[model samples]
Target: MRQIGLVIKTEGNRAWVKMQKGASCGEEHCPLSSSLIDDSQDDFYTVCAINSVGAKSGDQVMVEVEDLFLLRTAFMIYILPILAGILSYALLNYFLKIPSLTYTGTFLSVGIIAILLKRADRKLNFPYRIVELGTASVCISCPLKNRNEQQKLKP
Candidate 1:
């Protein structure tokens, strides 16, 4: 999977890339979507990736990650909660034989699993690389591009 991001900063071998929230970017499971990963409250999120392309700050870079990795992440994020709920309901119903208790257990299990996943996601670094720099996706509307144009126009 490949996505475009702006290199916000660089530290040694890793580059912190600011990613836009692409609601329709297919099945690519963005690990940074978890609030535990970023403390900042904003529409965008930042992620750390290996600086294979030696990209500098403000560069529009194409990041690459394995398809299988994304698939596993998606499953863990989307499917695990449902599975926990089903398992909780089954266990609770069998042991207690109460309908309301079973439903409550199911909901509680799902919420607990979700919270765990969110916390774990903070440390889950899906391996990614900065494959290409200055890709065609960097258009005039891009922040770095507009900054360059504005500087050129001044003085």
Candidate 2:
């Protein structure tokens, strides 16, 4: 999915982008809505992404993040642990024949796996990439443009 953002900071080949609030495809039921990070205070969210488009600080750019990556990460972080706990509980109960030991084993295994995944995430890089540098013409067609125009018309 694509998002329009301002390059708030740049470091080497990466940029800290403050995401603008609006759907890239201008669809109310966009699939990316669930994955897109949002902030409540300023209607903007920040993310560090690869600067493949050579965007500089203060420049508006389009960033792309794979939907598959988001779904995979979510599955691993949320679903995998629950599955692991269930499997561990079943196995322990069958082998040890003790309900208490089964619960303990399940919890301990889930904790260890969660901690290891957290460490692994720190060592891995995100799947986001900068796709293009925004132009004045791009802003004219942006979804936020209509909102801005409506606000101006209000007063």
Assess every candidate by TM-score.
0.72, 0.66
lDDT string for model 1 (26-133, tens) is 322655554456566554666789998899998878777899998999899989998898899989999999999888888989999999998999889889788878
The 10-residue segment of model 2 with minimum total lDDT is 146-155
Cα lDDT, all candidates: 0.74, 0.74
- Whole-model lDDT, candidate 2? 0.74
Inter-residue clash pairs, candidate 2: none
Can you list the residue pairs that collide in candidate 1? none
Q: After superposition, how far is residue 112 of candidate 1 from its true place, in Å?
A: 2.0
What lDDT, from 0 to 1, does candidate 1 have?
Answer: 0.74
User: Mind giving the per-residue lDDT tens digits that candidate 2 earns over 5-67?
Assistant: 778889999998886544654434543443443224434457899999889888878788998
> Which candidate tops TM-score?
1
